[model samples]
Target: MPQDCERTPVVRDNGRHQWEKDRARAPRTVRATTGATERDTGLHPPDLVFHAEYRELPAPCPLAEAFGVPAGTLLLERSYRTRYGPESAPFALVTSYLVRGMIAANPDLLDATNEPWPGGTQSQLHTVGIELDRVEERLTARAPTPAEARDLDLPSGAPVIQLRKTSYDIDDRVVNIADVTLPADRTELLFTTRLERW
Candidate 1:
């Protein structure tokens, strides 16, 4: 990672606009569905390589607090890492969590084999009658831990931007939470607000 690297906007509260545009025209179908994201965002390549895994980890303290669930709540977690190519460093590290009990109604949602579901989580939750009415993202910055640096290929002394995105349903209950790790050297965070004239 260099100090003057190009910035990539991986998340947009307005609508996953960057992802949608990329997925609409990406080539080479790979393990995960965001293959087009690399090319479309000009971050990676048309033939991006990616992998995903599922882990049942204890919910992070913040996650437990956000969902109003007990401290020991078990969370269904999906981890994904994508690279421009087999030999390239990952674009970012993403891990998403959902309350096991909340999604237990749809067994398919728990199975790793069913991942990269055609339309992603919002669509998958729809199968179980959950409708996302809003998304909120809280961001923070910190120096990368030794482990994070290795995973994201960060240079020494480089910091990282952490994003905690919470998805809420029509009933106002949180349905999904995602933690994204972006290397500061090669990433940029942008927020666009459209305000009407007073």
Candidate 2:
């Protein structure tokens, strides 16, 4: 139940690591900074395993509104589960949505076969000429649903953190939206802001 895991923003600068290319590679340890602090802990990307599933579906009214699209507009939904090991529960449940028309120019984006994408969502959007301007994450905690509790292997009374991440393009349009569910028992959220000297 200790908050032992750390999560941080993946900036464009950390060029795709080699582990992203070979999932079966031997475990390679990396350091992860603790929440809002400089303390580091060992983490292994190679030890984590994941699967992705993609589908095209009509955008629900709320989703359409978020994307500023017409109700029922086709959207690409990508779901992913990445666990510490083959037999472990997922670290987080992630679902991402993108407006189909916006990325249809790149047919590859519509296919799941091309996933485990080198640079992840930002890079995928780049293939269609979309440059990200900013990413906003809103976090909230609540009791997990029966399915979520089971999927995340939560102990009784343990809550889950629901994070809604909204990505905006350089033009200020919402380009992608993702909902991530993390087990509160092991997760830590960090936020840092730098202000220019007045």
Candidate No. with top lDDT: 1
Candidate 1 accuracy as TM-score: 0.77
User: What are the lDDT figures for the candidates, one per model?
Assistant: 0.71, 0.70
Q: Any residue pairs clashing in model 2, and if so which? A: none
Measured by C-alpha RMSD in angstroms, how accurate is candidate 2? 7.4
User: Per-prediction TM-score, please?
Assistant: 0.77, 0.78
lDDT of 1 by residue, 1-198 (tens): 442454344443344633443343334263244433543355544456667799787876888998889877989999977765533467678899999989889998888887556556766677688777777888899998898998877777989989888988889999889898887776656567768999
Q: Tens digits of per-residue lDDT for model 2 on 137-174?
A: 78899999999998887778999999898889889999
Residue pairs clashing in model 1 are: none
TM-score, predicted candidate 2 vs. hidden true structure: 0.78
In model 1, the Cα lDDT at residue 45 comes to: 41
- By summed lDDT, the worst window of 10 consecutive residues in model 2 runs over 32-41
